[model samples]
Target chain A: MPLVGNLRDFALHDFLYLVDRGYKTGSLMLNRPSTDDAAHLYFDKGKLLSVVRPQRRERLGELLIRLGKVSPQQLAQALQTQQMNNARPLGQILVEHGVIGQRDLQFCIQQQIEETVYELFAWRDGEFKFQAGQKPAPDDVQSLVPLPVENLIMEGVRRVDEMSRIKERIPNNDMIVRFVDRPQEKAANINMTADEWRIFARINGRSSINEIADKIGLTPYAVSHIVFGFITAGLVEVTRPTGGQSSKAPVAAQAQRVGSTPTRRSAAEPAYVEPPKKSLVARLINRIRGL
Target chain B: MQTVKMVISGAVNAGKTEFIRSISEIEVVSTERKATDETRLLKKETTVAMDFGRITIANDLVLHLFGTPGQRRFDFMWEILSEGALGLVVVVDSTRPETFRETTRIVEFFNEMRPAPYIIAANKQDKDTAWSPDELRLALRLPEQVKVVPCIATQRDSCKNVLLELLYEIMETAKEG
Candidate 1:
C-alpha cells in the first residue's frame, strides 16, 4: 500500500499483518527523524532480503550480548583478544572458545531481526520506505533468515502516529514528545466519545503506550486501535517515546504502595476523616508542621 | 586551528606508503619486511596496519596523512581510521589495470562515511606507457568530483601536485562544511 506515513509510527505486528495479507516485494526505505539519511530494507516476496544502514555492522557484537548468547565479560575479553589477533569476528571467537554454544549463537543471529526492528524504532530521526519484490531466500543453515522488517516498520509508525494524536489532546505541553517532531493541533469538532477523550488526555506525551493501556486497564492493541481512530479523526498525534522520559517510575511507585498495603481494613472505620478546625495560631503552627 | 586527517588507500603494493613518504615532511613510520610468499613476487613486503606522517602546509593547517594496509584482509580497519577524515587520496597503480575493482571498493567505502571529498592519484606515470588520466578515470569509473591526478611518486614536484589537488579538494569541503 505504498508504505504510508513515517515508518517510525508502526510496530513489528503491522509489518507482519501486511506480509500475512500477501503484499510482497519491494524495498522499505526508513528515514530517521531529524536526519536526512534513510535506511533501506530490501524484501523479496514476504521475506526480508537485506538491510542497508550506515554504521549498523559495528553494533553486531553489542546486539549478540543483548540476545544472551554471550556475557558482557566474554564480549569484552574477546574484543581485547581481537586487538591482538585481528583475524576473526568476535562472535566467531566466542563460539570457538566454548563461551557460548553454536545453537545459542544461531538463536542470537535469528533474534537480530527483532533487534534491528527495535533499533530502527528507537531512531528519533530518519525515514523508512518499503518497496515490494519477489519472495526472499528461505531460512536455512546456509542462508541468512530475514526478520519481519514490515512488522517492525508498521509498529514504529503506529506508535509515533498514536503519540502525536495524544499530545494534541493534552494542551499543557509539559510532557516531552520523543518520536514525532512537534505537537500538532487536532481538528476541532472531531467525533470523540468521552472515554476516548479521557484516553487522549492520558496520552499527554509522557505516558508510553503500555502506561496508557494500564491506566485505563485496556489491552495495548485495543488502546492502539483507539489511538489510531483518534489519529484518523485529527484528535491526537503519535510520537515516539524519548529515552529517560518514561512514566514507569510513577507507575512503579503506585505499584509499590499497592504491594505494601494491608489486605483487610475494618468496615466500621471512618472512610473520610476530617481535620479539626484550628485558630489562627494553631493554623500557623499546622502550616509550619506541614512544611 | 583545525587538523584534517586524510587516508591513502588502494590495492596491495600500489605504492600507498611510498606516496605518503614522498609528501610527508617527517620521516614515514612504517613496518616493512621481505615478502614471504606470492606477495614477494607481486611487490615486496606489505604494510600490516597503517603508516602515519604529517605535513605542515601552513602555520595553522597541519594535514595528518594515514596510509592504510592495502590487503583485503585489513578491510575492517578502514572503517575505524576513516571515521573523522576530511578527505581521501586513492593511490592507484597504472601498471596493473585489474586492481581498479579494489580501488572502486575503497572509494565506495569512504563515500559511505559522511560524504568526504576525495582525489584519485594514478601514480607511476614516469614508467613506460603509463595510462593517461582520462584512460585511468574510464577504467576506474570514478565520478567527476573525484579529481584524477597523474604522478610518479618518486618525483618531488609530481608528489607536490597530488598534494595540492588534495588540498584544493579539502578547502572546497571546508567551505561547504
Candidate 2:
C-alpha cells in the first residue's frame, strides 16, 4: 500500500528531509486538490530521476525560442517533424534537425526540471502519495539524474519566505509608482547599487513595479525589496492606475494593506532557532512510512 | 521607436485570446495547454503562461498585447504579464455573473499593483442573455469614472475600438506627464 497524507500534517520541506535521510527509492505524487494540478516525482536509490508537472510543461522548442536560442521558423520546422509520430521526443527532433545544438537541449532540460521543482514549494495545501519501488522506464532513467533534495529544500524555503515578504509590499504587479520628493542631501547619497539604479531609472510615474523589475533584470521579489527601501526612505509614492487621464486613480497608501510596503526588520536582527533534530526526523520518518 | 504594452485579462473563456487575435496584425504567440482542472469542462485548453500579439499603428508607434490566463491559480502570472503595461482591458462574459466577480478581483489585484488606468470590455454583447453595461458595473461594484465598453471579442472592429481607447488613454497620460 502507498503512504498517503495531507501536506498540512507534514510540510513539504520536512517530508523531503525524511526522504533524503532514509535513502529510499520510489515515486512521490502530489496533487493540489483544489486546482486539480498534479506533480509526479520518480526516484531511484534516493536520487530523483525525474519530476513531471504536466500543467507546467514547456517544450524544448518553445523554451529555446523564448530564450532567443532558436527562431520561430526553426522551431516550427522542428515541430513539423515531431508531429509525424516517429516516437521521437521533441527535443530529439530539434537536435536531429540541427535547429538547436545538443548542449542547448541539455541546458533547457535542466532549466525546465529546476523550474518544476522550485515551484513545488508553493503548495500550501495538497495531497501527497509515495509508492515504493516505482520508478521510470530504463531509457527515461538514462536521461534522468539524481537531484539534490536537500539543496532544493534550502533554496525553496528561502524563496518562499522572501516571496511572502516581498508580496506583502508589492500586492500585485500592476500598481504604478512615481518618484516622491526626497531630501536633497539624502537624494545625492542614495547609495544606489547597479540593480537599484536600474530600478530608479524606470520609476517614472507610469511604469509599474513589475515593469521596473523586468527593466532591472531581477525577480519581482528582489525588485520589491528595492522598492520597499525607496518607500521607507520617502523617495517614491505608489498609486493606482489613472486610466490614462489626469491623476484620478486612488493612492496606494489609502488603499488596502496589500498595496503598501511595510518596513521590515533590519538584516542585523536575530533569526529564529531551529527545532531539535531527533524528534523532527523521527516524526517525519513515521509520517513517511505511514505511521 | 515606441512600443506600448497593454494587458488583456478576464475570467476563464472571457475570450482574451480571441480579443488579441482579432486586432493583432501578426500571428499571436500563445502558450495554451490542456486544461487539467474544472476549467476543462468550460474549454479544452487554457493559457498557462501568456499570449503575445502585436499591431503597428504607424512607423513610430507599435502596440504589444499580452493576454493572461483567467483562472485564479494562475494569478501569479497576472503580475508577471502586467509589468510595464501602459493600460489594461478587462474582458467579461456578460452572460456569466461569476465571471464579473472574477473581473472584480482582477481589477482590484491590478489596482493594488500600480493603479494603471483600466477599462472593462463587456464582451459577448451580441449574446441575447448578456447583461447590460450598467448592470455589469453595478454587479462588479465599479465606480462611475471607469469606462465599460460593450464588445464582441471575436469581432475585429470591436477589438480595434478597445485598442484605440487604450491608445487614447496613453496619449492623454503622456500629455499630463
User: What residue pairs clash in candidate 2, if any at all?
Assistant: A174-B113, A174-B114, A175-B113, A175-B114, A175-B115, A176-B114, A240-B115, A241-B115, A241-B116, A243-B117
Model 1 Cα lDDT, one tens digit per residue, B96-117: 8888888988887667643566
- Tell me the tens digit of each residue's lDDT in model 1 across A210-266: 566555544444566666665554434555446756544322123232122122222
Candidate 2 lDDT tens digits, B62-89: 5567777676766645665665676789
lDDT of 2 by residue, A1-291 (tens): 988997778777877787888787898889897987888877667666677665544444444554455666776776677678557776677688887777777766565555566667878879999999987643231232467677778988987787677567666556677654322233332344434545654566677765565443444556767887777665666777677724321111111221122222222332232222343223322322331
DockQ, prediction 1: 0.00
What lDDT score is found at residue A39 in candidate 2? 83
On lDDT, the leading prediction is 2
The best candidate in terms of TM-score:
2
Candidate topping DockQ = 2
Task: Estimate the TM-score of every prediction.
Answer: 0.38, 0.43
Q: Per the 3 Å backbone cut-off, how many clashing residue pairs does candidate 2 have?
A: 10
